[model samples]
Target: MAFVPAPGYQPTYNPTLPYYKPIPGGLRVGMSVYIQGVANEHMKRFFVNFVVGQGPGADVAFHFNPRFDGWDKVVFNSQQDGKWGNEEKKRSMPFRKGAAFELVIMVLPEHYKVVVNGDPFYEFGHRIPVQLVTHLQVDGDLTLQSINFIGGQPAPSPGPMPNPGYPGPGKHNQQPCNLPCMEGAPTFNPPVPYKARLQGGLVARRTIVIKGYVPPSGKSLVINFKVGSSGDVALHINPRLTEGIVVRNSYLNGKWGAEERKSSFNPFAPGQFFDLSIRCGLDRFKVYANGQHLFDFSHRLSNFQGVDTLEIQGDVTLSYVQI
Candidate 1:
């Protein structure tokens, strides 16, 4: 399953190329940060920095610099006051100019574990308390796609994500308790529609994240949140390529409900990765694509607690799903 950042901690959208932004709550332990982008065609180097503040020559906690200059090595370092710290370098590069790549930097208690394209690459031990690092800067040669702040514990090992201890859906108002959604990533594959149990069930603060690619000839991509082993669907999201519309609805028994294709924007592209997130609300669900808000679907199954299984079908290759 793909790593899903917690709601409200998403990245800035299309922030001018060489991006520099504040780490909302600073770099807390147990939080994972993801940077997805492509290297420039004539790229020389790119560096990611975590520092004490945005002050001039601030104390740097971690500096990850990947160089494509002849040596082909990744350099890591830290700085205090305005002076430099010992540098750590490794000779391995997985990034290619003009090709898309996803980089994951997870802040752990003692160090930051970095993963590139789903593989463990390196670890940079902490030179300053992670909690004190308050800014993130990305500069140099690259095409930035996204920067997601996934809040939670570190990866169990170097491979698959461990079972998540996602916070529960406490009754926000007078709403009844909900069936807790499963807390781990679910593996999904194919051209056929499939349904899987949401471990405990669906609840607030719980998120459903989908990472997939729409084909060039894609017609539609649909994902539904429905009742347990039943035909009641509370939310149905279908992004139609041919129609250039996103349809939302609910299904009860065998009947299909009204369609919602009001939005005029098209965020889905053929043959590209789209990070989709569905965050539960007290009376509805807020959907997002590539960290941008898409739409919302109000509760229609009488009780939202019945949404215990997620059904996804249509024309797209699913890469990951976090339920």
Candidate 2:
């Protein structure tokens, strides 16, 4: 299948180093900046900055520097009026020399959540107003592959901008629930054995995002896309922590199909937070965990329109779900 760019954003590819550009729509809560790159083989240091302006003297809202020159560590700080704030450091480094990496900087109400290579890395509290940040600057010993800005409202806006192709309010009535069913408004702390209507059902380019934490005693988690009337599962994603494998399959006509149990790596861990996304394409479903591509499951049930419900169960506590 051909690659599909994320919804509501265009990604930049193979840009020259010392990259500087105004962030499209600026920064806002619920927005994420994704960077894919390879660290230089003989790397010393690299940094990503979200600043108020284009130049060196501009006030920085967030400075993320990973140093490998002496001791390997990541430094987080902010700059105002040419003065840098106190540094917050993490001793362990996630990037490896000469290795490819996927970095996601997710903007939240109180802080920025950084995820590296399908794992939670760190969170840096806001020192400067996120609204003042306008440009993104990346400089260091690395070869950038792509950069994408995804899922956020424009700065100064009161709410999230509607995602492309998603149905708006009153188009379909949602099932009665304790949580709000508004688009982009995350459902927090939902109980396990959870199920929700998928609104307009599945379609190419639509993505479902699930974010949560895995308990230390976690064993397994199951996420299923089901046919409401026929009780068939269009897609079943099961991550078995005990066996250290992720299994994918389908259940149609009351029988389970062949199980796919292969993956390059498992992204889930005991006591770690995870961000999982399943994007529907013309031919298959693309799965990503913590911003890293996991695998694709081809359509076993050809009728995408009939897959209208989402079900989740076992070993995880959900903090957010976006369909």
By TM-score, the best candidate is 1
* Alpha-carbon RMSD, each predicted model: 7.4, 8.0
Q: Estimate each model's TM-score.
A: 0.72, 0.58
**lDDT per prediction?**
0.72, 0.78
- Across residues 245-309, which tens digit of lDDT does each residue of candidate 1 receive? 89999888789999888753567766555788787878888777886678877887777876788
Writing each residue's lDDT as its tens digit, candidate 2 over 1-323 gives 33333343435766798899877666778777878778999999999999987776899999999999678999999999999999999999999998777788989999999988657899999998887787899999999866777655443335753332332222222333222222334454578888999876776667677766678799999999999999999899999989989999999999999999887678777765666778886788888775567889999998976889999999987755777
Which has the greatest lDDT? 2
List runs of model 2 lying over 4 Å from the truth.
1-10, 154-197, 203-303, 309-322
Model 1 clash number: 4
